[model samples]
Target: MTGEGIKECELIEWHIKEGDVVAEFDRICEVQSDKAAVEITSRYAGTVRRLCHEPGAMVQVGEALLEVEVADEPEEEEDAAAASALGPMPPVQQLAPAEQAVKREQAGLAATLASPAVRRVAREHGVDLASVQGTGPSGRIYKEDVLRLVEAASEEVPGPSLQHKLPEQRAEQLSRPAPSAAGLPAAAEDVIIPLRGYARTMVRSMTAAGAVPHFHYCDELDAGPLLAARALLASDPALGGARLTFLPFVLKALTVALAEFPVLNSSLSADGKALLQHAAHNIGVAMATPTGLVVPNVKAVQGRSVAGVAAELARLQAAAAAGRLGPEDLAGGTLTVSNIGAIGGTYASPLVNPPEVAIVALGRVREVVRPAPGGGFMTASVLAASWGADHRVVDGATLARFSNVWKALLEEPRRLLLHLR
Candidate 1:
């Protein structure tokens, strides 16, 4: 089952079927929804009685996923022990409201009931989550509750400062389906298709990301020295013949910059308080896959050389293309590098994926004429780098300074050796 408003999922593949013996924690099937592609595991050791749904069927969360006839020997006195233990306990009707709030069997939060998405929205609007009543499963605070409070607050705009309403307007616009040619004329046979799986997931995730205040910083780097460096590295047998691209160099330099300015390598805690500066730089690189786009990081790039980064990146790209990336591969992305240049874009304003304070878009290399250091005009290859950062955490000077470090390394490729380790 999926969380955060996902009530059902499309069965992508079933690893087990009718009469297959399953052990506890064994993966039985994989399902995809707007939230993610997850493997459903078995909780009991038993033989499957039935396969309720076929591949590609939509299954509800509350419905019987599959039947299990326990294969383990039963404990005969278990029912009697449970009844005797409960008989000595008072019912909830006899307890006070404060006393009733105690965890019945498991330890958890007292009354906090909001998903990450809901909590993020509430934090943005300065809504007190504790005061908002929850109406979802297990008293989870839904997105509607956060929006209700925001709308009520917007009703009291006393002056003509409409800027206060811009956030809501942008959110409403983003909520609509983005068509490639939205202004084109419609025909009688024009069909409206609903987003599913990866596309649907992108919409929801990006929608939440859109709520964040973002700032973009643009700069151009001379790629002349960088290209020469790549050629030199290509001849090294230590690279293991891994395909070398501009991304590895870009990522390698980014890590060097991050080591100096650790703030950019951090994420806000769940409650939107305190900063978590990660010791390891698990840098995520966006790659296209057979299923969709996946940003699996080259874990601990801070400790790897440029050649190592290339090798690790090759492995991740292969895994993504095969649809074999696990949850660990997809999660824990502290920062991301979107190589829009690979797909032929010259400039991009990439959105900052939440929990990641920053993202840099690498643009296609181009030839440009510039003044030489010795005074004559020189022709050089250049790449444009545009960075988008969460304004709540990153400021212009910090990002610019960080970019300068990255720029120095790329502009003068030999500088990377000093930080290569």
Candidate 2:
């Protein structure tokens, strides 16, 4: 599994179990980080002796995950002779009475039939191996049995420690109504599905976004030229019938504006004493996946032409919807753009993805009546553009100026072509 900046991940499932023979590079388990779920593969061919962690356990990077019993490689004659000269090894110690009893209950082995990994899991959850019934060969306890015990315990009491409650108080707590689901009152027939994986991560990230000193800057852009540009691109044979969208134009314009206002392309240091300016214009495009929302950025957008940006955006959107986005695709974003307009929103104060200073939201393009130079009202296509910036690094005035530049480029779509790489 890829760790990179991830410190720990929840063990989601095990593909290989104890006593199962696995080949090198065979997928052994699935672990989910905040960003994505990844499959962990075996590094050596061997029989799985024990699973170190159970499903739903938070395992840290570099931790031993499982124990494997592999045959030792043959040693050379010189090494064997050197080992023999060192004399015979000492005898193994006998088990204590309590240990002997535990060994008998768990399985009749020289040591506890459970491996160190399984023991670690049992210790973490305070599960007694002597009480659990093992289904493995020779009554060897497995990780699944421990998980089943934990799940059963959780279902008996859904929340809070009732042990300290008085008899009357416990009755009152149990009589209270169950919590709502998805902000709606639960009907008797409603199925309560808990958020997990990407959805859970999104909730945490959005909560952190709320804690940042943030402000919004919104303005309308004349979308007549943008719409024209889209039409022109759609007619070009070079496009190969690929659907051209307003997102590439918006992304390109934002990249150009970022070059002018470099502060918007930087993140604040953790201590808030310094600004970290990124050299590349990696702009994240927010897209909704079936499981949750994901923002996989197009790297180095400052160097890509409109067509290139469009191609990359299409690739990323497809990968994200299919839940196949790689770690790199979801990282290194200096700014983000959320096209809520595609979903029929007029405007939204999109949340800033942390470490980045700003995010821009594009609302749907619609017709608006405005005064013409001749003093007559004329209808023009317009888009509501909203900007959210971390106020710690970007002042209101700086964000306003940046938005003006982005809006201007979109209003005069030809200006964007001049700046394209």
Candidate 3:
């Protein structure tokens, strides 16, 4: 809810449970919305009184997630501020109507009861907790019991293949193969795995993007200067071991072009009446991760040096790989650049990222023979660039001219220094 337009969110996990004492600003929970995974923190010093919702439950904006028993103090105004921070209580909704009932019923069984950690272990090993004999007090299962069950089951199996020996209940769930989202039921052969998490977010974003009118422009540029520029920067001592890639050069060149043609660095107003031109060139770089594609932008790219942009790019990549990207990292992108070249492509008609009016994707560079300025044919390193823009706002001539400006800066990177502050 920190950013606009996100109405619903899925609570990923809680950092503290009931009765846990917490200080102001302590991490409360991690939640995922349409944009990015965000960490909710405590604004009041208190003890966790009750958890209003469970993990994976969807809650709407301005809803009270949990009840906190704030420590009573003489400062009445401070206590009132804390109370204001806590939103009104609202109903929490789950993806499946029967999930809560099923979880409660399972927890009621003492004979098969197991802690979450132990249950997770059993699930990973395909050992049903009902089959593991509880060794703890009151017939409660423990981690050791699950491990023993796994070991004993492995001994009975002739080879490393344990799929055939999975507990009946585990095997049944696997055979059904339906989870996360609504999908078709499974049989012996086919299994329908519904998209969730980033995959789901991507679907929503792309669907929204398609509703807007789009036009594409494609051209190839001689990348001889771009390659040589990267080589020169790679050895710079001031860069301090930052991975010098063509991305930073491309980003810097983009900023130079964006400075002259700021209309491309704009988003359509919600009412579709006014075109909101952003002053800062917060350019997003489309990245591919294990989960899905995420565009985390560098703020104020026009103000940052090529080296500075490279450092931030590296930081974003590492944060994305670790799933630590926050709402700030994903929001406020005015325009985007996708290096499709890294993935072995030379051109792409990418959908313009919603809100932003345009996106540029770079294709793989190749050596080809072309006419030299001296007139004869010569071999040149060329990189393909594709541009997709909101045809409603940006005309073909504007994007073409903008693309030319970008191409000029990237081709002769030395010109980038003129615009450097």
Candidate 4:
């Protein structure tokens, strides 16, 4: 594959070598971004044939990185039919269309030609590259063109491959059992889940959390004051570029409350009979990823300012989004905070993150009017916080007290800041 930006000093790494049979979406290489290394995944299923660029080489976006030899009998059949009907088949050439549309594009023009990645994808899905219209720089065929062509063709042509494969061939591939693990015997039937990035972490965490006895406590908090505080902060010149959300404030408040209620901040021992109270206050933030849920922690959040928290949160969110987090980011979390609000959920009793004493969920905020002390009514953001405590370690009274402290701190954020300092 092509690596455009690689330099003598700058390095890129290719995970899979040429001729390796890789599944679709497998990570094949990694490149360094400004912050960290980012992996590039395979777009199609095939056997790798050649590496167009050497590992650690610089590559451009449209340049061929590598070549894959995929089964293309369906396309071969279509090509033969076209050749017979058209007669003395015209040499493959390019065409400009009225507007950009896949399946109506040109093929001979180098600038309008599809990249190796896109070509492989198109071939697998039986997309006629010539039909797609180029929309890239100087009317070049793009990756998006292949996607659009495939989607449109899918609706028109239902099952082209169903007719190609024999029934016995399909059954043989389906019934064949996968090999057993090293030194282990095969089962009658086994379902194997490949451990990829996010899925891998989910398996580890879920397995660990299952050992603890979890008890959930959920409540709706009046977020009117918190929202008002955010508006006030956003208006300040010093807080410029800082769009205040309930999370950082909640984190600040929770950090202080966690300090007071040390039991909630402590983890249960693996033996299931003791507490492991930590000296430092590390908070894990649950983020939804393309594969699954991943909770990466921000170390010593109690020591950071509102702006500091915001910057770190943005960095972690980006890392989580790009699937670039390391093991350290997923470890040493004293407690977790899950914000399902982004997904429009009002409330969720989040499961306890392993080793941590509790996990708190912040649900969506909604406009609700409550009776005003001096007048008729006032509108405010009604927010919900769902807390899951390890019943073996923390009791209901301790949890109620912890919630009360957090409520007091969030309602009066200035006081929360004082405690943070």
The top-ranked prediction according to lDDT is: 3
Model 1: how far residue 199 lies from native, Å: 3.0
- lDDT tens string, model 1, 1-421? 3555666676778898788888888888887764457777775677776564577655655444565666544452222111110012111132344453464223454336454445656765666676676654345456677778667767776543334334655466558586687678865632335456666667766897898899999999999899988887886888898988778888889899998999999988778888898888889988876556667888888889888999988888877676556667767888999988987967788898778889999999999899999998999998999999989899999999999999998998888888776
Tell me how many residue pairs clash in candidate 4. 17
Q: Write the residue-wise lDDT of candidate 2 on 100-176 in tens digits.
A: 55767576443344544456666656667776766543455567777687677778978745543445556777897
For this target, which candidate reaches the highest TM-score against the unseen true structure? 2
Q: Which scores higher on lDDT, 2 or 4?
A: 2
Compose the digit string of candidate 4's lDDT tens values, residues 1-421: 2223432111256788888987777887775422234566766566776554455443444354555555454444323222210012223343444443344334343333555556655664555666777664335566677778666766786864532234554566569787666887655633334344456557767787787788888887888788888877865665456556778888878888878888988977777777788877789898887656778787887787776676677778888887677556766889999888878888787778777879898889988888889989988778888899888998888898899899887877778757645
CA deviation > 4 Å runs, candidate 4 = 1-28, 31-195, 235-242, 374-377
lDDT of 3 at 344: 91
Error of 3 at 211 (Å): 1.9
lDDT of 3 at 33: 70
What lDDT score belongs to each candidate, Candidate 1 first? 0.73, 0.76, 0.77, 0.67
The TM-score between candidate 1 and the true structure equals 0.64
